[model samples]
Target: MEWWGVLEGLLLVLVLAALPLVLFALRRRWLARSGSLVECSLRISTRSSRSGTPGAGWALGVARYSGDELQWFRVFSLAFRPRLRVTRRGTTVLQTRPPEAAEVPMLYRDQRIVVLADSEGRQIDLAMETSSITGLLSWLEAAPPETRYPV
Candidate 1:
């Protein structure tokens, strides 16, 4: 084969590999422009699932408040629907702590971990910027007057 043919083949492979990444970035940007998107990390309790291990671990995602539910979507996924949704009613902020020494590499400097418990006694963890905690708390607090959820 000629040198030009080899070069052309290599170029085609590189462009094909990069096409998905470019589309992923474009999709993320579109999500940001469509709503009040936030950079968040989510961890649910130990449960068997297809996406990851049976044990719970932090997965990077974006969250947006919609009515009474906080919709979370995986950053790496191209899915149109949320991966998880937690309602404001009975959503309690159990505790919040700074990221651990081991977690520092995975999280932003201003981010902290917030633990929440739903009314059904299931636990959900969220990591978000320090500035966004108050906003999240307020969203939980601003539920319908009859709900009366506390942070």
Candidate 2:
């Protein structure tokens, strides 16, 4: 009976520790499901920073949206009147799409884009210029089907 109690306690602790991880994984899965398919590459032209600038000078981002629900959320968030551009590479976005300026508790001109992975360390970076709609569409139209699907 004592052993049973000990096992039960251990199980409880294990479950408690795992709950957050499970929730996190589920959230990521939900986001991925909501993300749009990356069909092709876009030519990204960003504001030209001074020559020899180390960081991403100019770039735009394409928010990936897979469904209407998320799409509405995107529009709703933007209503707050904050102009959010994509963060540069190595940056992290809390959510895939930009939020409303009014909705955001605090506003930072530069945004962070989150990266999900399975590794010891995690990464969050400012969103960088991804590609342009015209360029992406062109690439998508040209690329073979095998290359377009996400892995």
Candidate 3:
């Protein structure tokens, strides 16, 4: 093959490798500008864990609050849709505390961990900024007078 052919092949490979990254960036930007989003780390448990510590694997994501629901989208993903949708009705905060020594290194600086459980009994652990947590709690508590959501 000629040198020009090899160069062209390399360029094609490079573009193919970068296309996904470019798409991910574009999706992230769109989600950011969409509004009412907070950058948060989430740890979702399919089943209950015996030990009472946040899962070591926390997925970094942005959460957008829709009417009575919070949608979580993974940061490194190209999917524009939310990976997890949490309803505000009957959601309760289980625990709130500072990150443990091991968790501190994995989490962003000055972030607090809040464990919450939905009506379905699924536990969601989220690490977020103080203001974001306050906003979330406010939203949870903002339900109609007849609806009761324990914060």
Q: Which model scores highest in TM-score?
A: 3
TM-score of each candidate structure, all chains considered together: 0.80, 0.32, 0.88
TM-score of candidate 2 on Cα atoms, chains taken together: 0.32
Q: List the residue pairs that clash in candidate 3.
A: none
**Ranking of all predicted structures according to lDDT, beginning with the best and ending with the worst:** 3, 1, 2
lDDT of each: 0.82, 0.34, 0.84
Worst 10 residues of 3 by lDDT: 46-55
Prediction 3 TM-score vs. true: 0.88
What are the runs in model 1 whose C-alpha is more than 4 Å off?
1-8, 46-56
- Output the TM-score of candidate 1: 0.80
Q: By lDDT, is 1 or 2 better?
A: 1
Question: What stretches of model 2 exceed 4 Å from their correct place?
Answer: 37-63, 66-126, 129-151
Task: Rank the candidate models, highest TM-score first.
Answer: 3, 1, 2
Q: What RMSD value applies to candidate 2?
A: 15.8
Cα lDDT tens digits, model 2, 78-148, are 13221232212222222333423432333234443322211222332223223423332343334354343
Give per-residue CA lDDT, model 1, range 46-132, as digits (tens).
Answer: 323323432337788999888889999999898778999999888888899887776666665578899898876668879999768
Model 1 lDDT on a 0 to 1 scale: 0.82
| Candidate 2 weakest ten by summed lDDT | 67-76
lDDT of 1 at 36: 83
RMSD for each model, in Å, please?
A: 4.0, 15.8, 2.0
**Superposed Cα deviation of residue 48, candidate 2 (Å):** 23
